[model samples]
Target: MMTQGTLVDATIIEAPSSTKNKEQQRDPEMHQTKKGNQWHFGMKAHIGVDAKSGLTHSLVTTAANEHDLNQLGNLLHGEEQFVSADAGYQGAPQREELAEVDVDWLIAERPAR
Candidate 1:
């Protein structure tokens, strides 16, 4: 019998939306594929990882070209109270988006220059 279990990687990543070309940047999928290479297709998968539980609260699979700040809103929309991510997720709009949802989002600041 073919075993088809609910393999929930939990952090697999967001799915894709369209084919990439020159004009388009981000897509519905989280990853993208490149051309010519053996393993092509480059994609970006937005993910929200819980620091303590390592649970994926939210995930968005957009094109690799998608901005972290742009996708930051998706993470904030999750039920998690606090979230952590790289500097790519830093910005004003993201903060406001989180605040709007009444979610206590805390993004660590980079050390002083």
Candidate 2:
């Protein structure tokens, strides 16, 4: 059973840009995206975790270029009293697809540099 709070996050799974298969072509499912000062090519793994237990409850994957916010709706289980995420998900509550979701959002703010 899942808890009342859910934590969501995404990570970039780096892949080599060089193609090794017989086709000699890069993976069609992976794409390049810039993070900080580096460029990464691969897929992004979006995960939803049970806050109380720290166990994963959901997962979604997309091309590296996909925005983390795009997968927020799919990571919810509909039973959460609150949802927590990093600064990448800052506007989750205002996203049209999630407008009707009543959970309290605990999105983090980007730290000042």
Candidate 3:
């Protein structure tokens, strides 16, 4: 069976920071990022899912502050006919990377005020 498309996105997972001890104070692999007025500390999981069947096809974990587009290349399976991503994955650099491949890129349009 031929794979239809790949849906790409990322989500942050918060790390617990309840202890005062140096080693327990924070997770070494996790980091912080500010979105709007809130600051979050944790890691981000970048994922790609099959658009037609809703099955996960790829996953990559990175520090919280890592940008979403940085993991785009790793999420592609080379079998997808197209790729769909969010606004966070838009821009020239990302487009250039996609240009190297033969799949169609479907990036969401960012709302303008």
lDDT of 1 at 28: 37
Tens digit of per-residue lDDT, candidate 2, span 1-113: 78599999999999888855678877888999999999999999999999999999899999999999999999999999999999999888888999999999999999999
Q: How does each model score on TM-score?
A: 0.50, 0.94, 0.85
Q: What value does the lDDT take at residue 12 in candidate 1? A: 26
Q: What would the C-alpha RMSD of candidate 2 be, to one decimal place?
A: 1.1
| Native-to-model Cα distance after best TM-score fit, residue 54 in candidate 1, in Å | 0.7
TM-score of 3: 0.85
Q: Candidate 2, which ten residues in sequence have the lowest lDDT sum? A: 18-27
Stretches of candidate 2 above 4 Å error? none
Error of 3 at 59 (Å): 0.8
lDDT of 1 by residue, 1-113 (tens): 11111111112233434555577765434454432353334455666555555555667766554566666666543344445554444553346554665444355576677
Report the poorest 10 consecutive residues by lDDT, candidate 3: 17-26
lDDT of all predictions, in order shown?
0.48, 0.93, 0.83
Positional deviation of residue 5's Cα in model 3 after best superposition, in angstroms: 0.5
Q: Model 3 over residues 24-70: C-alpha lDDT tens digits?
A: 55566788898769998888999999999898989999999999988
Q: In model 3, what are the clashing residue pairs, if there are any?
A: none
RMSD after Cα superposition, model 3: 2.3
